[model samples]
Target: MSVKIRLQRHGKKQKPFYWIVAADARSKRDGKYLEKLGTYNPNTNPATIDLNLDQAVQWLHNGAQPTDTAKAILSYKGALLKHHLDGGVRKGALTQEQADAKLAKWLEEKAGKVDTKKEGLSKAQEVAKAKALKAEKEANDKRAAAAVEAAKVEEEVAVEETPEVAAEETPEVVAEVAVEETPEVALEETVAEVAPEETPAAEETSEETEA
Candidate 1:
């Protein structure tokens, strides 16, 4: 029976996630598989891949032909490199101990690279968040300043209206005071005129009696 390495679709539509499997060549795409080697999820920021390195390399050594996508996945996880080292050991070009040392060193270097990439991504996300916060603060400040300006203009308009209202009331108050004073002056003049007429009549009567 021919063996093959391929992806088995598992997640929902438009959000695809897969399982790496070693199966019989005649099996359907998502049908029963001989062995599950790993998982792949592309929903994450840098995509997530998890593989059983020993099992995958063993399958490769057992003559399992991997599909193009599965091959790339295996390469990324260093399964292909490990297989190459094992082949070199079998061919007597290198000892098993030397191959193990080389693989350990390579895995260490790859880990350091992954750590650096994660750090860079974290820093970028922080910067983007800070920028968004700053923009929101600036927008809030602008709105506050505009509200203050509008209030000040309304206050000024009210102040101006109050003086105009006072000016209009002043003329009415002055006219009322003038009307009250005119009535008192007219009464005084009438009393003076009556007293002069009475004095003249008394003088005339006395003059006639003396004659």
Candidate 2:
């Protein structure tokens, strides 16, 4: 019975999650498995993995052939490296203690790199959010200033229109003044006629006296 180490697909569409399994080679892709290794979640930033390193190495040592993608996953998580080191221990080329120390150091370095990437991503998001907020605030302030300027312009237009409206209304007032002075003009004409009559009467009286 040939056993294979592979990933079984799960999770929703587009967002894929997988289970690492040791299963019979003849079984369907989603069928029964011999042993469950762990899980792999690629939706995360660094691609979260929860692998049992000892179990993976054991399966590899037992000749369970891994699929191409699973091989890469195992290689990335240090399972392949541990298996190789164990091989060296079996061949008397290196001690178990030396292999353990090297694996430990490599894992520590990988973890540090993951942490650095996470911190950089977080800082970049914060900067972008702050910049967007500043831009929005500036837009709002510009709109408010434009509205105030428009109001001032409208007020000035109303002030300019007031005098024009009053000028239009003044012609009737001038006509009324002209009509009120007509009676005084008529009285002056009557006085002029009486003066002429008095002049003629004076001339007649002088002649009678002389006679």
Candidate 3:
């Protein structure tokens, strides 16, 4: 029976999680597994992986064939390298202590790289968030300025319309003043004409009496 190292799908749609497993080659993809090695979560920025390194190496040593994606996962987690080192140790090409030391050093370097990547991603996220906030603030400021300008225009229009309304009423005021003054002027003229006519008639009567 051929055994294969593969991944079993789990988690929700679009956000995939997986279990690294060793299963019979003829078994259904997610149906039966010989042993679960670890888990893989791709929802994170760095793609979180948790693998049992010793178990993975042991399976590789036992001739368990890894699928393409599983191979990459195993390689990334240093399982393949550990298997190779173990092979060298068994072949007398390297001592067990030396192989262990080399594996420890490589693991340290890989961890450092992962840390740097995580830090870079975090910084990028912060920058993007700040930019979004700045854009929103600018949009709000533009809207506020527009509102203020609209208010100013309305006030100016009201000020301009006020003169037109006053101008419209101005004619009525002038007409009233004209009507009040005209009555006084006409009365004075009538009194002057009557006095002149009566004076002339009195003089004629007096002359006739004397005659």
Candidate 4:
């Protein structure tokens, strides 16, 4: 039976995880496998993968056909590269020691690149957080300033209304003073008229007595 290298689905819905496996070509996608290779988790920032490089190279040597995704995974983890190096060793084109050295150097460089990517992501997150905080502070400041302005407007309105109330009461005070002065003027006029009538009556009495 022909063998195939493929991924077997696992993990929860919507967050798919997988296991790399070498299995009979006729088996169901997630069924029995000849060997468990490694795991692939796509839920991480830079999709995490763990592979048994030696075992994977051995499978490739034995002519296991890998699916496209499986081939990419093997390539990423350097299994394909190791397989090629082993082929060159078998052909006497490269020594085993040389192959191992090259693979190790490549793996080291790949690790450094991954680390640099992680650092860039971390710095980007910090910048985003700082920007969000600054925006929130600015929004709060605007609200505080608006509240102060509203309070000042209310105070000015109250002050303006105070003068209008005082002006309304001024007419009543003037009316009271006018009423008090009118009564005094009327009494003086009445006293002057009565004195004139009494003087006229005394003159008539004197004339009659003289006659």
lDDT (Cα, tens digit) per residue for candidate 3, span 98-150: 99999999999999999999999999999999999999999999999999999
Per TM-score, the best of the predicted structures is 3
Candidate 4 lDDT tens digits, 13-91? 9999999999999999989999999999999978899999989999999999999999999999999999999999999
**Backbone clash count for every predicted candidate, in the order shown:** 0, 0, 0, 0
Q: lDDT tens digits, residues 103-209, model 1?
A: 99998998898889989999999999999999999999999999999999999999999999999999999999989998899889989889999998999999999
Model 3 CA RMSD to the hidden true structure, in angstroms: 5.9
- lDDT tens readout by residue for model 2, 21-130: 99999999999999999999999977899999999999999999999989999998999999999999999999999999999999999889889999998999999999
Off by over 4 Å in 4: 165-211
Q: In candidate 3, where is summed lDDT lowest over 10 consecutive residues? A: 9-18
lDDT for each candidate structure? 0.95, 0.95, 0.97, 0.96
Please give the lDDT score at residue 49 for candidate 4.
Answer: 97
